[model samples]
Target: MSTESVQGGGNDPAIEVTPEAAEEALSLLEGEELDTDEAGLRLFVQQGGCAGLSYGMRFDTEPEPDDLVVEHHGLRVFVDPASRNYIGGSKLDYESGLQAAGFHVENPNVVSECGCGESFRT
Candidate 1:
């Protein structure tokens, strides 16, 4: 994966999205029939997981006022400023296997994760 920095949000570099992940996100967005120009994938970190932090993603029609928007492979990604600190330099990847197919994050800031791998602590 390649790394690139985004301006105007904070010191941390914006999270990177793999080509496969970008394509998958685009596919999902298309399935919802959302206007590509007006829609984006929002990535955020929320509290309350076993490890104190849990990642979240969803299709959003509009970004927050202070969101850092990055376009990858023609797909728009919105990362909130607060989550940027914990997810900077991370890579978003989609993995497919016989047993599971899902999006996975390789976050450099993650110091630990729960046994079930549902939550993380930085």
Candidate 2:
């Protein structure tokens, strides 16, 4: 998508996507035959976890009008304003190990998390 199409909260975006994640996301988009320029991964925070916050993501055909858009390694990430408050300064990474292999969020804003590691609080 064009830079003008992105409603970035500021020139400096707090979210970062690692190269491995970008590559995996790009591959997924291509495999789905989605338009890379418009379709992207949408990251957000939900309030159902044991610690009150949880990370969520999905492939979106396009970003919402007010979503913050950040691109890295040719991968576009869309974040909603509300979620921004909970997930700022977070890193999106892809792990290909046999166990727990999937997208993981390394959030620096987290203050604590459940012992099971499925939820977090800030």
Candidate 2: clashing pairs of residues: none
| lDDT string, candidate 2, 1-32, tens digits | 22223357775446788889888999999999
Q: Worst lDDT window (10 residues) for model 1?
A: 1-10
**lDDT at position 61, candidate 1:** 95
RMSD of each: 2.3, 3.2
Overall lDDT per candidate, in order of appearance: 0.84, 0.85
Q: Which sections of candidate 1 miss by over 4 Å? A: 1-7
User: Candidate 1: deviation at residue 9, Å?
Assistant: 2.9
- Model 2 scores a TM of 0.89
How displaced is residue 45 in candidate 2, in Å?
A: 0.4
TM-score of each: 0.90, 0.89
lDDT of 1 at 95: 94
Candidate 2 lDDT: 0.85
